[model samples]
Target chain A: MRTILFLLQKEFIQIFRNKTMLPIIFIMPLVQMLVLVFAANLEMKNIKMKLVDFDNTATSQEIVSKFKASPFYNIIGYSYSVEEAQNSLIDNSADLVMVIPPNLEQDILNGQSPKVQLLIDAINGMTAGLINSYSSMIMLDVNKDIAIELMKFSANQQLKQISIKQRFWYNSGLNYKHYMVPGIIVILVTIIGMFLTALNIVSEKEFGTIEQINVTPIRKYQFILGKLIPFLLVGLFDFALGLFIGKLLFGVPIRGSLFLLFSFAFLYLVLVLGIGLLLSIISDTQQQVMFLTFFITLVFVLMSGLFTPIETMPLWAQRVNIINPFAYFMKVNRMILLKGSGFFDLIREFLYIGIYGIISIVVAIRLYRKTS
Target chain B: MKALEVSHIYKTYNDITALKDVSFNVAEGELFGLIGPDGAGKTSLIRIIITLLLADSGEIHLLGKDVVKEYKYLRSRIGYMPGRFSLYSDLTVLENLNFFATVFGTSIEANYNLIKNIYSQIEMFKDRKAGDLSGGMKQKLGLSCALIHKPEVLFLDEPTTGVDAVSRKEFWEMLQELKQKGITIIVSTPYMDEAEMCDRVALLQKGEIMSIDTPQNIINEFSEELIEIKTPDLYEVKEKLRLEFGKNSAFMFGQSIHFSTSSKSKSKELLNEFFEENNFNIESVNIIEPNIEDCFIKLMTKDS
Candidate 1:
């Protein structure tokens, strides 16, 4: 135990003495939080639209005015020629173009459905799909109004309709930042916990200091724990700072118990640091550790549902995420912060991460040799 | 009991053999040296004995404890200073020393007397970072850290390989002092002069022990008479001598050429007549006593 304290003291001194590392530890997380939360948003707004109406009627004018009033579409201007509107789409000036053909009011009055054409840019498949849906909904509303008005004048009968209302359960406003902030916090803690621990021992190996330590009476467990505990505390501290930034900057709600959130975070950190230790044991130099950790962390973050929904991914990918530690924490972070999930709600994640942490650490200790 | 014992130790890395059937023993309180150039398997042998590396097939008994089977208990009883500067460079000198002391489960206050003579030399710079120290000072700090635990056997691999002459002298004196405290020291170096300071040394060359004995005995064991030829053209004289008498007979030693031959009486007369016939200016030619280096070259060439 005394040996471990000495080792811890030595490690902490080295960690703090590194001038370049201090800023990375304290400031990089806040920068990542501020930048990635706002930049990684999928919410689309201010979609530029060009309207080409051939019919100079009140019905055509009403549709143009409705498109202009919606918050999502930014109407560029009215074009008389359909060819000119299509040119705007080619030049990327407009994301969508709506062309109403001639005789649109006469066709509705004569009980004929007039063709309303929408030309949308399909470069980004996702945004194009959203634009199609929004424009279709607007047209549907316009059709219903005309039908009701025509019925009132023709016959004294009321039209029966079924209206649907939507209420978003957790994120009422559908704030993308609120959903992203917690997930970015998971990434921040993971970077600190895994990268630092992975590079720590390998740097000693490069410096030839580990050989000196190997000859001493210090047990393997003491050495491993000494390395693990300091980074664990640093990771937790970074996690807390991330939580504070999430609450203060993004106004992300922390509805669940803070204690339960931190408890799971501690377990997840252990699992991550354990893997780092395992990497360090297998690697011989800092460069090897850096490349290995970078590759693994990149895969973990990308497959973790940080940017995309895991359910929407292929079936094999979802199965692969069962072993991804980052996915578990990314899910639990949102669950506790957004949905107000309790300990019992996250029991399965807790069990898997706990078991993973034990296995990795035990394997690390078993592989570490005093003599080779 | 012997401080260290090895029998037929062998080690290899892939196809490259590092130590080949190497064996030696160090008595208690003896200052032993493993004298060889780089890649002479000096570091490999020391690492195996200190329980930092495994031998391919061998039996090593350090203080009567099996090195492989009982490494855990033996680790506390031994101290090793690797060839590289292994102390924490980012740490202060005092912090580095204190850390090693604590790691061995002992305080500096407990082992203060053991490292005092060496530690006091750099105690004034205790606050300085180890990386900022000079090469000599770094070596001194490494030695101090190794001695802080007061182990039964201390293994130092090339402690004076890159140190200045004055500092190298001082390091040897410190080792002698440590020997007086009843700690067996096994130090390796490529400098032939340094071998004279050890009580006994195993002259190693290319993964094999050439000879093992006291420095005087190794020198006395040179079977051939040695002749030192001083001339203005040293390289030419060496080449001429090698062409006349085989490749292993003549080699450059510092400022002169040393030629070894079985016939001491006739060789000097023959060399003078030959130099005169070749129109070469000879400064002096006299039979000289062989040093450790001469004995090493003779033994190394004999094997090939």
Candidate 2:
């Protein structure tokens, strides 16, 4: 235990004494969080609309006004001809084009259905789908209003209607930042924990100091524990700092117990830092460690369900995510912050992540040879 | 029991054979030197013996325990200074020293007597970063760190390779002091002069030990008479001598040419007549006692 303390003391001194590492460890994560949270947004808004009204009728005007009132669309212009609307779509002035037939009011007055055409640019599939859904919703509203007026004067009226209301749970507004903040915080902690510890022991190898340590009487477990504890502490510290900044700058709330979040963070950091140590032990230089760590972090972050939903991914990818510690942490972060989940809700993740930590630590110790 | 022993140690890296059936031993409290040039298996042998490397085939016993099976037991009793300066450069001298000491389950005060003579020289600047120190200071710090555990056996591999001449001399003096304390030291160096400081020396080259004996004994055993010849055109004369005698008979030695032959008088007479005939101005021609370096060259040439 005393040996571990001495090693920890030396490691902390070296980390704190390095002038370049100070800003990298403490300030870079917060900067990344601030920029990525606001930049990486998936919400679609400000869709440009071009109107082609062949019917000089009240129903046509009402449909156009409904689209104009909604925040999702911008009415670029009212086209006199279908060619003008097609020209607007071609010249990039509009993303959506709506055409109402000449007899829209006549058809409604005669108790017949009138067809509407909505032309959407399908180049970006996601935005196109959203635009189509929004346009259909507005057209449905117009048809319901027209039908209700017709039914008001009928004496043999036996009409029944069912209305469905949607209430989004947890995130009532469906704020993207609220979901993104926790996930980004998970990435920040992983970067600081894995990258630093991966480079730490390898830098000692480059400097030739490891030889002096390797020849000593220290046991391999003691040495590994000594290396692991310092970086674990540093990783946890960075995680807490990120949480504080998330709360302060983005208004990200921790709906669950702070103790549960932190305890899981500590375990997750062990799993992360253990993998770093294993990389350090296997790699011969700092450059190799950097490249390998970057490659793995790229894969891990993309598939960890940080930016996209895991349920939407293919079945094989979800199976691969079972081994990713980052995925577990991302889930736990969202569950605790967004769902107000307790430790019981996260017990399966906790056990799996804890088992991974033990396995990684054991493999790292096995690979780290005192003699080579 | 012998302090250390190696019986038929062999090590290879890829296709290159680093040590070829090498064997040697050092008695308790004796200072032994492994003298060779770079790439001569000195570092390979030292690493194998220290348990930092595994030999392909060998048996090594250190302090009456097998180096492979009992490495953990021997780790605390042996100290090693690698070929390069291996101290933590980011750490202050005092911090590095304390760190090594603490890892060995002791304190600096416990072994201060062992490293005092060497450590005190850099004590004033103990707060300075080790990387900022000069070469000599780094050497001293490496030595101090190696000795901080107060081990019975010290293995120093090329400790004075990059040190200045004055520092090298001081380092040897410190080793002599260490020897007086009854600590067995095994040191390797590329410099031949360092061989004289050790009680016994092994002349190694190309993964083979050409000779192992006291430095003076090896020097005296150099059978051929050594003659130093200098002239205005030294290179031309060396060429002519190489043509006259075999190529191995003559070599350049620090501004003079040294020639070795069994019939010294006959060769000297013939060389004088040749220089006169060729109109080569001769500065001096005299026979001097062979040094350890001269013996090393002679043995290597004879072996090949």
Considering every candidate listed, which one attains the maximal TM-score? 1
Where model 2 places Cα greater than 4 Å from the true spot, the runs are: A51-57, A78-125, A146-159, B262-265
Query: For the second chain of model 1, what is the TM-score against the true structure's chain B?
Result: 0.98
- For model 1, the superposed segments whose C-alpha errors exceed 4 Å read A80-84, A106-115
Q: Give the TM-score of candidate 2.
A: 0.94
Best by DockQ: 1
lDDT of 1 by residue, A260-346 (tens): 999999999999999999999999989999999999999999999998899999999999999999999999999999999999999
Q: Once model 2 is optimally superposed onto the true structure by TM-score, how far is the C-alpha of residue A109 displaced, in angstroms? A: 6.4
Model 1 chain B: ten consecutive residues of lowest lDDT: B260-269
Candidate 1 to native Cα RMSD, angstroms? 1.8
Candidate 2 residue-wise lDDT at A31? 92
lDDT of 2 by residue, A252-357 (tens): 8789998999999999998999999989988999999999999999999999998778899999999999998889999999899888899999999999999999
Residue A206's lDDT within candidate 1 is 94
Clashing pairs in 2: none
